[model samples]
Target: MDTPLISASALLGASPAPLLLDCSFDLADAAAGEQAYVLGHLPGALYVHLDRDLSGAKTGMNGRHPLRTRDEYAAWMASVGIGPDREVVVYDRQAGMFAVRAWWVLRWMGHTRVALLDGGVDAWVRAGGSLATDVPVPKPVAITPAPAPAMPTLDAAAVLARLPGLRLLDARAPERYRGDVEPIDRVAGHIPGARNRFFKDNLQADGTFKPAAQLRAEYAPLVDGAAKGSVVVSCGSGVTACHDVLAMEVAGLGTATLYPGSWSEWSADPERPVEKSPAA
Candidate 1:
């Protein structure tokens, strides 16, 4: 249970079943996830929307998915029936891209008993688990926000102050990192010193995460010698970045800080330096 992931088979047989959260999402179609959930999902599982539920309202500079205040987040969790005592399981069909965001947020809320469903809903279906269309009513529970010793994060200014000494890992694709393409963010380049580590690199061809030892090895070059705390993971607006953070934890590399504003916030500011490879 030290790891942040739980297999579908293991979840299927657990006594006193844990709360299941289906975080399926499609970046291209925001409503597609809920539509999919209505069609079929794990029995008793509740749907958590990436934009509607997990993220805060976006201002011009706060990035697309701004961080919710701890108090506000605690209330949301409570409303969703998530309490300290609940052993929560989060999953999605998109290779954990969206599920990891929920997992990270829960951890940041100081709920250590939560974990991502390994390989997502597809894994469950492959394991002979059936999907249901019925949605269950969740009993709300009051939650007291505990101090999060595990999840650490940095704001834009803090990241700027840290500079070259801080190891910033951009979880976007290489093309985006190189300024060749930027389908979402206005800017096309990356933060001045950030290294690209595309979140998809953490997954296998089948969409499950790679083995721990292999992950540890693959992440070595990006992390370099920086201590886990000095390493900051980021993506478009901090969602996919959590995938990298989870990968690091799964590799036994300890918890890394998250740059929640990520590229969207950084690029919004003309004052910040943006880097890109030579024209290609």
Candidate 2:
């Protein structure tokens, strides 16, 4: 299928066979997503909240927003009228932040025919597409999410086992990764033997992802000489880390595994070693 970047104009012209989802959310403001949907959004677009719709409940130990089960996600998709045949287009108000999470979730659930709205809502407005104040109420359609393959993933035990060979890529900011400041999670610092690669670096100034060749060059040094499936990706939670995974796909690197527990889950356990300094 086409790479997951769809232009605003192209989305505007597409027929209703394609499902458009508005994934606008603010982690700080819990109510902003629904409120924004109520005020205005793309015509015929359905709203998906990052906290409520996309993620599972947060226990003290599980990562900030761990992915919901496949059955749960499939039920959500069905309730939102997403069928197997529809082309799902997801967008967020802020430069592809929350939307990319939805894109990743869809992919994780074994749905490959999804795309992100290039430049997101800003680009849609700039393209002069008409908006709607009336919220859409979609009739539910039955959807069966296929079972996902057992791709490379790491639990605490698995992570401990492969620490020597696996390179853990932490996608948080350098400050967050360095344990200098942490505003969200209870603990500071990062996983031992992890390297920082801030997720924002995946995008250009215009909010579009960098070209595949450029992305490959940037990530080549990191994965060089490692076996085909040696790299593991993690982040503050499991959200923004998907941006790195998406970038890797764009770069033509095979899909890397997600450490869904991430730093939040790792730090919760006193046994998991934390590192303050950058890996040498």
Candidate 3:
């Protein structure tokens, strides 16, 4: 896969500069996240709210952070000056977690030109890029997002039907995956047939992603004999799971379908089986 990662240095002084987005958010304190962005962010960067700009109204089984309608998202993009030809670069302070959400969301809306700022906003500062408290205003540009009945998504029933070969990967922490401690969702365990692969494993110690080859090697065994499209990526509320999907794309493993109705939705259904492991 062609890399969708942009290096901080490469982005510096880029001609026809990309649309910079700050996507940092605290799951617990939504207001604080936006405040953090207002305090200091990349010059000319616009702030994207995780709960507002990136998500849609939640219907009964739509899961938390359900994706907004394609048309609605397109309008939002236009209002923010995003168009098909724009080079959009999204970043966050939290090791690409929230940023990748933006990346996946854009792709889901049929814009493949969006890229993630490698290692996120922190990397920018480390590369000597300065933060600006001022936000830039740009003229709105209209775009027509391609039509799709829905994003490539897997429901809980579909996941259960996939059975033993499905390769359902859970992006939660080991403790949460093993049912030791679930900080967010109501349930402490994971989907019955899911395997634990913390989203952070895709990155290096410096908060940057591991090289493509390394990522490929890391994921090969876990996905052994499974069709690339057969693998389903998921997490508590379908957020960090995008991180795994992004890593797979970077590794050239091909795209994995997302289970937007992740553990949060899965656990809500009493009929769905939950699994806990002594070893996560």
lDDT values of the candidates?
0.89, 0.82, 0.86
Off by over 4 Å in 3: 149-151
Write down the lDDT that model 1 would get.
0.89
- What's each prediction's TM-score? 0.96, 0.93, 0.95
TM-score winner: 1
Give the runs in model 2 whose Cα sits over 4 Å from its true position: 150-152, 278-280
Worst 10 contiguous positions by lDDT, candidate 2: 145-154
What lDDT tens digits, residue by residue, belong to model 1 across residues 1-280? 4669998899889788999999999989999999999999998999999998899988889898888877778888998898778999999989899999999999998888998988998889998999998888978997777565458999999988888677889999889988999999899999888888999999998888999999999999988788756688999999999999999989988898999999999999999888997644
Clashes of each: 0, 0, 0
lDDT of 3: 0.86
Candidate 1 lands at a TM-score of 0.96
Q: Which candidate is the best by lDDT?
A: 1
Which of candidates 2 and 3 reaches a greater lDDT?
3
Off by more than 4 A, model 1: 146-150, 278-280
